[model samples]
Target: MAKTRRVSEEIVCAAIRKRKKRTHVPEADAPKAGEPRSFVIRRGKYAPMLKDLEKDLRQMMMPNTAKELKESRKNVLKDFVQVAGPLGVTHFLMLSATQRAGYLHVAKTPRGPTLTLRVLEYSLMRDVQSAQQRPRCPQTMWHGPPLVVLNNFTGSEHLKLAATTFQNLFPAINVATTKLSTCQRVLLLDHDRASGRIRLRQYSIVVQPSGVTKNLKALLGRRAVPDLGECKDVSEFLTRSGYGSESEGDDPDTTRVELAEDLGKGNQKARQSRIRLHEVGPRLEMELIKVQDGLCEGNVLFHAYIQKDPAEIAERKSKEDEREALRRQRRAEQEENVRKKESEAKRRRRPQDDARGAKRPRPEGRVPWG
Candidate 1:
């Protein structure tokens, strides 16, 4: 046998390094002609305004920021409601940011890009000026045109920022104003009122500083009741007309009668009732029902009644019953047919099986061959 020579580790490593050094590898270079290169394209002008908008968006998306925004909006709406309540403005329609954006209309004007905002104008029957004599009971009709609000938002420092933005995007449809003022004070008002068209009322908003104590002289003095229970408080706001408990003052004859003996007793499930005396307070007592010249009693505006003939209903019921009975009868007949077919198949197969068994040859007796 020839003696095999064992290669040393250093010799093998040197041979691998020599081979690697001699090997030719390709290099990664820039793309040549006709080669595709990745590139990005951006639309619109990318300026400081875009940066500011992006920054505001990021701030709005931050944690707790969205909640704070919602709370702020609620407070703003509540303030509006409070201010409008005394102004005889009972209804309000608040549009969301998306809705406001959808209604935005842009038109090129000589001055610049003018913003027109369309807002609902509420006109009460009382506000309508008629030449005819007022009836004893006037029928209050509520209908108003869509108010048109115009603004440039150039110098909107004193104006409400949100309202200014809203008006810029969503303008009113109709132009109506109580009086004529300067062009700056009114919407679309020009030097020549006769020749000027598209003139509308300029929208103005004033947010009063909260927490300012009103003058005591302006308000009437009244006694204060610390506890709500001590005062007889009743609300006219109820789900149904005759649902709420009658006020003791409204109906002095109204009385509470307990049907169960357990009632008014100190039982676990008993309802406790007591004849208590309390004074009415101004704060707790609210007059929900208003009395106005055109106002009417009752809150129901529209009612619908659906009537059906008894004979038709009875016919429909009878048809349904007949359908159900027919379905049951059909199901029973199908089951009986299936059972009969199975029995007939079994009877026919039994005789054939017996004949086949008889035809089979019996095993011959084995003959022993000694």
Candidate 2:
């Protein structure tokens, strides 16, 4: 009996240990100090805007624009970034329909953060292992569940679509809509006519700014306020039109009280003030994710906490170190090669010098030594 009791206690302890291991850690519940507070913002109205933007972008890529496409894309992306938050463009992948499974776009932000977006368009129904087909970012590992966003649907339809997409993309991962404190993954889904398949995509949002800025001065010229002060309308119109009485009127009419206020003075002050006011662009940092093609509409996108893993950081550092080491090795080898070439050239010339000896003119008094 005592042996059985001892065995039961052991089993109980093992069970407790197993349960502890299975418990999940909610890492992304709160934004880090420097991290932007992530909100699952959604609005379906932005779908049309996305569609139009896609059309314009496609038109720009037609022909003779391969060279200019990069700049054009940045500009286009800038506009998209501006409208994304209001128009709810966070879930659409900003790639063309022809983009393959592993295409990526990177935009630099003026405030020193990089916006990197990638497309992973593979199928879970395939015979291959899902992980093998899953798209991967080199140094990034999303360590939390994502917020799931449903577009063009609401009420029961929204819930249904979210469920269906979640199952299709993340089959085994269990997520709860009510208990959302432990999630950090974002899943965006939309119907794709090009492929005729409901496209499922996963995207993450970290607040970042688009570095490109519209140079107000460059666009509108150095002078923001028009020089109307000196033009005919303000300078000579009243005088030329005889609106102003002659400065020295023949009859000193006291009936019209001499107006003490200068009418043009206020206009001048207003013009100067307008000129002094600098035209600055919007400063709000945009957090937008672009899915190549489709519409994402809903009041709530995916919501999940996000956190960085120490392992991933260590791995990235190791990779950088490896690259630095390789560069040093290559530089050392290059230096060695240069030295070897110089030494070989000197050695080759040394024999030639001996053969040639000193080619000085023989003294007139001295015969050849031979």
Candidate 3:
């Protein structure tokens, strides 16, 4: 009996240890302090194109952003901004459209400095996939955020601000601890210096075994049993040039790299792997229209088309200040009026309250036995 009890206790302890190990979260996976979380939402009337673009943007900002956030025409920017504070949402990507064009607003939460970009052209994910012969979108591709890559953003002041805003939209990665497996996607923002336009491309990072023939890879890593009826022997099938021969025949020196860690199936550490970026949908060509001092409002810091002189800027600032002062005065007067109304109401109720508390006249009737 004692031996059985001891065995049971040991089993219990082992199970507890296993549970603890399973529950432990690595430091790299834990939410970092001041990490940016985002909300990609649409405002105003629904545009069919904008709806799909919003979905793509949400997918691009995976894990750290709300994917299924619902918005209606009745919902205003203030509604989202008000809730953003308590929920720790640090950025907002608001998509809206007019009859003329669509706009993407990237704004910092609870503060100023919003970047507005006009969408010149866009391609949905479905459209992109339709054009490709084989689109590589894995089920777990969006399990983590995409790595942001900025190109040619060093030209002007506005471009610098835009780049900063774009960078903060995703959480920062630590080079020392970040795993290669988690980097399944890439968000490339390429800016054209002459055209002043930005091209947004989303790609999946594909790592395949290097120095392996296409036929051999297919035989080893076949998802389903590939038809073997074409050849009498397996060697014949392996030696034959297949449909995707051009990809396999390319020089591997340019794209091949030594893997630092184990990534994906058969991509082991210290092994040579070919890294390829496959464009996975939702391309956008946009131009920075303006940068504003506030969320979707306030003084324009940069405008692509409009340039104001110093005197004009000064006059605009003075006018804004006067308008703000007037608004404050009106608010103060309204508060005073409300306070007076409350006081008058209290004064009127005071006598009635006192009368109720006072003793009624017991005089009319004769008193009796005590």
Query: Cα RMSD to native, each candidate?
Result: 32.9, 33.2, 8.0
Off by over 4 Å in 3: 1-33, 45-49, 223-248, 330-370
Candidate 3 on 1-370: residue-level lDDT in tens? 9999999999999988775657775454444568888899987664555888899888778777778788777878889989999879999988888899999989997886899899999998889988999988985777777899999999689899999999988888899988898898999999998898999999999988887767666775766877879789877777777634524766559899999998755677999988899999799999998999888889999998899999999999999999999999999999999999999999999999999999877755577552
| Model 2 C-alpha lDDT per residue in residues 1-370, reported as the tens digit of each score | 9999999999999988874434553344222232221111111323332343333322212111111222232244445456545532222223333322232232222111222233333322111223344432311213333444555333444234443433322223343333322332345545433332344444333211112112321223233554446656633533444233433223223222222222232222112111111111111111223321113211122222343377965786688689889999999999999999999999999998988996777779776884
Tell me the whole-model lDDT of each prediction, alpha carbons only. Answer: 0.29, 0.35, 0.86
Give candidate 2 misplaced runs (Cα > 4 Å).
1-113, 117-266, 270-307, 360-370
Off by over 4 Å in 1: 1-306, 359-370
TM-score for each candidate, following the candidate numbering: 0.18, 0.25, 0.77
TM-score top scorer:
3
Model 3 reaches what TM-score against the true structure?
Answer: 0.77
By the lDDT metric, which is better: model 2 or model 3?
3
lDDT (10s digit) by residue, model 1, range 29-101: 2222322111111112222222322232222111111112222322543354344434333222222223222
State how far residue 366 of model 1 sits from its true place (Å): 6.7
**Residue 176 CA error for candidate 3 (Å)?**
0.9
Residue 9, model 3: lDDT of 100
Q: Identify the leading candidate in terms of lDDT.
A: 3
